[model samples]
Target: MLSSALKAYVNAIDDPYTIYMDTEQNSGFQEELKGSSDFEGIGAVISKKDYYIQIDEIIKGSPAFAAGLMMLDRVVMIGSGLTKGLDVNQAVSQIRGPK
Candidate 1:
């Protein structure tokens, strides 16, 4: 309701990284930062930028690094679908696991 509106309004502004997280989300984010790569992935740091998820960093020796996915690479598609309208959270979920 109100929270969603506020979040949407804030995210609508110029700051692409501006975001809102609940207690569960905050805790999950912290946990995800500490060795959550047990699952297979390309090993790239992604962030919200320009209405899409952009590669902020590529871990050395990671599959993403091996695949030549460098910093600032715009991820327009995840798997077979386009990322045109997906939010950061949606993109992150899609990016997780073996993909």
Candidate 2:
């Protein structure tokens, strides 16, 4: 399938920051990066840092801020899943959803 082919091509290049996202993934990724007032997820901006997902910013009055998460905090896990091998897109998708 096209998805697999795209993944294979990206993997061939071996760029951690270069990822292929499907339509839905791109939509969610855009929403998360835009800093919209009405947002889902933990209300924190994140990025891939080394082998982990790092929280770059905690939005004011959001669940993440309420939970006392700080900038540069490395997220090792999401629920029961480890974040070690996940790219930024995958991490964002996992983090975004209804409260």
Candidate 3:
């Protein structure tokens, strides 16, 4: 459909910064931009480093901070799933959800 078409167009453009986001992806992107609340996430900023995910920041008073998660802590797994080879967005989808 339109999403596929847009994705194809973006792929054709061969620009690393050009990406087509579907409704859910666009919503997530917008929420991240606004730093909005009411979502179900650990409130820790994470990034992929080498083959592992690392915590970059833990928001004050957030569940992550309450759990004693620290910046630079490596994430080995999420629930039953191993975090190896996961991109940041893949890790985020596993972490974030509707409350």
Candidate 4:
């Protein structure tokens, strides 16, 4: 599951952005297969000025859908062992795979 802070970051944005997935050789593919095949769990690129946590487009079910996440929901934490920092690059890293 994604951290609350990361979720909040996604929920606070209100703008048209592109979500991308990293395709690195080291990334594990078996784990990604555990989730829905349709959604490869990729990274997103939201606008910087879009409040970062509260906006209209940020709402769930919208074009910028976050699968199970909702809009305006702050992401306060992530991962199990360590509280990893939440950023666009990090988000992309999580969803990316070996290409």
Error of 3 at 32 (Å): 7.5
Candidate 1 structure quality by residue, lDDT tens digits, 1-99: 876786578757846445555454455545545647554456665666667877765667777888899777899998898987787668778877335
Q: Model 4 over residues 1-99: C-alpha lDDT tens digits?
A: 344465456546733352222334114223333444554443222222232322112333333365544433443333442223445445444434443
lDDT of 4 at 36: 43
Each candidate's number of clashing pairs is 0, 0, 0, 14
TM-score of each model, in listed order: 0.58, 0.60, 0.61, 0.29
Winner by TM-score between candidate 3 and candidate 2: 3
| lDDT for position 42 in model 1 | 61
The candidate 4 region of ten consecutive residues with least summed lDDT is: 47-56
Choose 2 or 4, whichever is better by TM-score.
2
Q: What value of lDDT does candidate 2 attain over all alpha carbons? A: 0.74
TM-score of 2: 0.60
- Tens digits of per-residue lDDT for model 2 on 1-99? 997798679758876456666676556546767866675777766766579998766667878899999877899998789999899778877877344
Pairs that clash in candidate 2: none
Each prediction's whole-model lDDT (CA): 0.68, 0.74, 0.74, 0.36
